[model samples]
Target: MKRLWGTECAPAWRAWLDRATEQIFRHPDCGAVERELLDHLEDKATDLMRIFPGLTREEAEQRALEEMGAAEELGEELARVHSPLVGELWQLTRFLIRAVLVVLAVECLWLLWKFA
Candidate 1:
């Protein structure tokens, strides 16, 4: 993925972001979360580089990822935060509401026809 810093991310960074957001339910939400994570990674890497001028960009990025901890664990936490159950429930509620509205519209049409 391309970084907000206007540079293409390394394959390792891409892989990490993938693993980190794989568990998120919604694809759009996953993208947003990934961007946020990438921003944090970039900030951390920049800070690291500033702190240690001897560190290469890749080295700083690697250290930033390490400091962020395990991707799997972060993924699980993100998954919980972006719960599929809530999204599913909202979808169901919308479907039910639309169904009810359709039923009422049909009934209104029927009444208008009968009373005409």
Candidate 2:
């Protein structure tokens, strides 16, 4: 998944977030969810590092990932909540509305030309 605001993140964390967010149907919502998950992961890692002063940053991050459980399962649960069918329907509706507006604009322009 693409990182927001060009912020750098660990490769492992990025990979896990990508796997989890990929299951979401709506692309727009994926970014928000990824950001939220990343915040949680970072907070967990920070707590771990504080608790264990000797632990390296990478080690702390690793422990946090382990605590989060499997990415695929989390993704599947997220997918269910996001609803692929609803996302598809929303996309279709937006496209149809745009097309209708374009058609109406052209018809109005033609009518104005005919009257003028």
TM-scores for all candidates: the values are 0.69, 0.68
Please write out the lDDT profile of model 1 over residues 1-116, one tens digit for every residue: 33342325777888898889889867656778888998999999999999999999999989999999999999999999888787788789999999999999999999999999
For model 2, the stretches where C-alpha displacement exceeds 4 angstroms are: 1-7, 85-116
Please provide, for model 2 over 24-113, each residue's C-alpha lDDT reduced to its tens digit, 9 standing for 90 to 100: 867676777888899999999999999999999999999999999999999999888777787788889999999999999999999999
The window of 10 residues in a row where model 1 has the poorest summed lDDT is: 1-10
- lDDT at 99, model 1: 100
Candidate lDDT values, in order? 0.86, 0.87
Best candidate (score: lDDT): 2
> How much RMSD separates candidate 2 from the native structure?
5.0
